[model samples]
Structures are given as C-alpha cells and as structure tokens.
Target: SPTTANLLLPRLATDRAAMAASASAPPHSLLLAAVALAALASVAAARDENGVYDPCSDTRIQRGDGFSFGIAFATLGAFYSGGSVQLSPCDRRLSLASSGQLAVFRPKVDEISLLTINTTTGFNPATAGGYMVAFAGRKYAARSVPTFVSNSSYTVSSFTLVLEFNKGRLQNLHWKKDGCGACAKSSSLVCIGKQTCAFRTQSCKSQGPVDCSIGIQLAFSGTDKHESVLNSWYEVSNLRQYSLYGLYSNLKDTLSGQFNKFF
Candidate 1:
C-alpha cells in the first residue's frame, strides 16, 4: 500500500549487478523511513516546501501513491509520467522474448532516469532481456511528451530496449564509462552522461533471497545547465512478490537510496 512507509508500487529498467563478495546494500530502506519522518514532521512545519503532496495524502509517497508505482523523484522540469506497462501473450512483436512486459516514459530530453522498478525474482531464469520504451530524440519539440509504446517482448519481430535520444544533441553523448562519479562496471570504464555505465550478464546467478540492483547515470554535458547525481535505480522480479508486504519492503529500500542521492 502506498500508505505504508514500506511503499510497494511500480517496477524495471535492467542493466547488471554487484561486485563485492558481499555486495554493499543499496541503502534503500534507511532512506524511505527518513522520507516518511521528514514528510510527517515537516508536513506542519515546512509544508510549503513539500508542495508535491496534498491534504489527502496523510503519508508521503508510498506504493500506488499517485506516481508511487515507479519513481518518486523527477528532474528539475518534470510533468506527467509513470505506470505499470505490461505486455500480453499474443503480442509477438516485442523483441524481448516470451510474455515480456515493460514500464517506460520520457518527460523530456534531459530527464534521463525513469524511477524504474522490477517485480520478477532472479529465480525465474525465463526472464532474459528487459522491458523498454521509445523516445522521440528530436530536439525541437516543446514540452516533448514521450509516449509509452508496447508492453511485451518475447520472440520479437521488431525493436526492444531502444531509446531515440535526440541524435542532434546526443552526438557527443555516447555510451562511454570513464571512471568518474558514475563509472562502476569493472569492464565499461566509460561513463554515460555524468554517472557510470556497465553491463554484466553473470551478475544474475543469485545465491539466496537477495535483491539484485543496477543503476546507470545519464551524464548531461549539454548546453542546458544541470546538477550532478543525475539518477539512481533498481529493477524487480515479477516472480518475487506483487503483494504489499512481500515486495513493498524491498521497493521502499530501493527508492530510499535513490532519494538519498538527491541530498
């Protein structure tokens, strides 16, 4: 429930996995609690600052809490965005494979991160590629509202995981991971945008009930002046849990870390 401090809502946008023999936690849980407390305490004190919330919202952003199914944070210029984009059994057009589903959006060209979520668990090896959305890459359109396309990708006939970033402006912004604040992948040392970029397949093969997380930062070096800490992320396993208590705990933890990056 979005009302629960342990928000259970939207889900993915997959990339890879952990490195440390005992990988560090994504810091998602601790932060969610903090946000809850912040919203609660400040609701009366600094209510003006937290303009996004409404009088009806007794609690902060939780699962199903309006855009709660996905990400809580949006770029400086954020408008309408979010949803549980899923695919059907008959849609064989999606390149993803069998019964492939997705969740995607593009509020703007600079707004790269999509507060992505994942519902399936690593146990289901059936899940191979990831869900995806298409972006208009054309730079001129004002209020360039990026629309949601297909939902599934099993035995595809066309495209999947494709984003048409304005080729004109994106001429210089290629996928390169140069160990700056973003570069984390052991192999792809080139950072995309300001953050890091990495791709690993072996990162899956899980050990136990562990949440696998991967984030890619979109470095914006364009003329549009923007701050760092572009975005943070995590994908879920559908096989894992859709029920509130089961998935909300992990989902809150994921969003918590993402929110922390903002501060």
Candidate 2:
C-alpha cells in the first residue's frame, strides 16, 4: 500500500545505507550507526502520528511559559442552533458556523493583561451577536464555552479567560466574570447588567477619553484531566487580577497617541 510504503521509507533508507557502510566500518562504528538509525526511526514514527501542525492538536507548553491560542468572535446566529453537542472550535467543520473574526493571543501564565484591536473605521458588534470562544489543544481540544461580548446595549471591554491544565497538558478553558468590579472605580467605565463593564457602542467615545477597542485579560486555573489538585501556574504567579485597568490605561494612552494613523 502507498500509505504503508511511505511510512516505511525512512527506515528502509536507513537500513540500506547502514548495510552499505558496514563493509568498511569497525564494530563500534556499526553499533553507533545502528543507534542513530533507531533514533531516526523513532522520530519518524512519532511524526507519523503527529502529522500536520494543527493549533487544536498542540499540547506542548513548558512549565512557567505562556501559551498561545485563537479566539473566534461571531454573532449568536453564527453558531449551530441545533441541539447537538457543540463542536470544538478547531474542528474544520466549524468553518460553516465560525466564518467570523479570529484573534490570536500569546499571554504569559497568570499575568493579568489587556489586548486591544483597533480598527480604521468604527467597530461595531451589534450586527453580530457579539460572542466569542477561546480554543486550543488537539487530542485534548479545549474551547471556552461561548461568552457574550457585545450587543446593541453595550460592548464589554474587559474580560478574563482562564486556562486549566493538568499533568502539563491543557485541559479546559473558561471565562471568569469580573461583575464589573474591576472597572467600578473608573468614571470612564459603564457597568452593564452588573455582569460586565462595557462601553456603550453608540456613545463609547463620548462617554470616555478612551478609544473604542475591545480588551481581554487572560489567566490560568484548575488542574488537567482527572486531577484533584489545581495547577500551580496561576497560584504561584501571584497575579494581581485587578491590575487590568492599569494595563488598559497604558494601552489606551499609547493607542491615543497614534490614533491619527489608525483612523
């Protein structure tokens, strides 16, 4: 079979090359070649299973290192309305339901941070249902349950997405609501339904000095599959979760300076 033959090519080539070299090589040289060949074969076998690079299948993240993944934003209508179980965001079949906007972020573990996406023209989420999902991992495909970001009433600017890991592998992702408390002190922020702080799309720029950009803060928690103990990445980092406003202020100042270029 073509598939079987393709899979065996690496081993076959190594065997043939080794046989040709054995005639001139000493015993130790032959032994070293055999070891090298075995290593190559093992690597090939591993790659055979790994196949192409799919962000959904990525499970390699070092302890103390930040992770990278994608976020898809769309209207409620963009998702399947059927009663069937929700599919992983990384599923190719999801293209039908997720032909919306995607934003990728690589955030350090346990760090409270903000990311802003500026548009040349005004940004509006009202046309869409203003929902988003964060997703990563393959064999352990993890997707945060859908979260509402905007509507005709308001657009959320601050959010926290927690990544859960167990045994060094990502297990799940979920949204942690701030109940608008993080933005309570700032006169510039508007609390929406007490679930989030948002900028009213109609008067976002008029209500505050800040630009109308979407911001998300990331964190990590929980343990991986079937684990009782929580992952230490979040706890050990001693994150100041409320620092999101400070970070947002810095980002806003920097963005304001270059507002002319964006517009």
Candidate 3:
C-alpha cells in the first residue's frame, strides 16, 4: 500500500498543481506546454520511448536484458553535475559532471531535426527509434562527461554547452587515462591507479590547435569509446590551467540530446 500510495500521491499532487496553474495562466504557448507535461504523470498514460510508463524518477536503471543504450549531446561541453548513471550488463557508464538532476526526459519518441543537424550520420528518431534525455547542473560552474566503455563503438557528432557564466570556456578537449601517467602513444592503458582504464591499447589523443577565439568544436571519432573528458572553467584564468582553480559554487546549466540505438 505504501508503494501504491507513493506513486498515486505524486500524480495527484501534480494534477492539482497543473489545474491550479492552468486556472491563472497567461501565454497560450506556456500554458499548453505545462498542460502537456502534467498529462505525463497520469497512471493511464501510455509508455514512453524507453518502453516504460510515467517517468524514470527512480535513480537506479536496470540493464533491461543487456540492451545497449547511449547518449549524444545536442552540443559539446554541456553542463551536468557529479555522479554516474550505470549502464548495467556492461562496463560503460554515463557521468553527470557536476550536478545530479534529471532536467528533461521525453516520455514518447518524437521526430526531430536537431539530431540530424549535428551528426554526420544524420540520425532521425523516426528512423532511429531513439528518444531524448537531458540533465542540468547547478548555477555557477560545472562540466559534463558522458564516459563510455573504451573500445565500445560511439560517435560524438555534435553537442551544446549551456554554461552559467557566458564567459566560460572549453578548458580541455582530449581523452585522458583512467590510470596514471601521461597516456603515451602506442602504450597499454593502465588502470592500477585509476578507477577505470581506457581502451585496451588506446592512448590519449589531443585536438590540436583549438581556436577558442573562433568557437568550440567537438572532435568526432567513430571507433574510440575511451573516456573523453571535457572540462569547463572560468575564462579569467588565462594563464593558469588548473582544474582545482576557477571553480564556482552555484553553477546552473543543462544539456539535452538523443540516445538512439546505433545499427
């Protein structure tokens, strides 16, 4: 009864709030969106793209029969908080760099053009059967790292960075060793000192001559599933390249994109 009560209460409360809000709404567009979102909390609602009704407010996600899931940012260097989401039945995991809030997750699969605009392969949800999911960070300074199992095939075609401070800059754009030492070329990626190791034989690759003066570019690679770490820091630290420095307390931001199954 407690579990049932728990589920029913949130929906009831959400409905009440939606009704109250709608009674005094201003803009048609805003009111329409609010009503559409509230409808998702109903028990009679249909299943979402992930094949589950309601939302994944639950923290833990099961492997669900070893189904391969993935995340592609609408833009690179998007902001998210700390803690990682385990993609069970596999060594792969998704990390929210700084915040731990699930900001946006669509219930149903919808066709969109953003996926195609950025990815070279031109992924469309109508064709790919993938849905969008997103997470946001606190308001100040943070980074997002969607780390995957090294050697696991993936592509980071395009993503957007929603930085709290407009002056924020792309700090690092390279793969680093989960192990110690500067991951030299053609060397075995060690994990003795690190929490996890990179690909078996993959080494850290740098994006040479990045022009922040012009804009940020998300380097694309098809074969590497190495831990691609992207760091975001205050631009005022022009000379000092330190992760410890230039950190903030209340950084608010979000990043969204699709996790379509790649065939």
Give the per-residue lDDT of model 1 (tens digit) for 103-162: 222222222222223322221212422322222112221122222211121111111121
| Top model number, TM-score | 2
- 1 or 3, which is superior by TM-score? 1
* Each prediction's RMSD to truth: 17.1, 17.4, 20.6
* Stronger candidate by TM-score (1 vs 2): 2
Backbone clashes, each candidate? 36, 6, 23
What's each prediction's TM-score? 0.27, 0.63, 0.17
Give each model's whole-structure lDDT.
Answer: 0.23, 0.50, 0.20
Model 3 spans > 4 angstroms off: 1-56, 59-70, 80-263
Q: 37-129, model 2: which lDDT tens digit per residue? A: 011010111111222123445654443344556666665545444535665555654543335655444444333335454422354545444
Off by over 4 Å in 2: 1-54, 64-66, 81-84, 96-98, 110-112, 119-123, 182-189, 205-210, 222-241, 256-263
133, model 1: CA deviation in Å?
Answer: 8.7
Model 3 scores a C-alpha lDDT of 0.20
Clashes of 1: 36
For candidate 3, give the lDDT of residue 191.
44
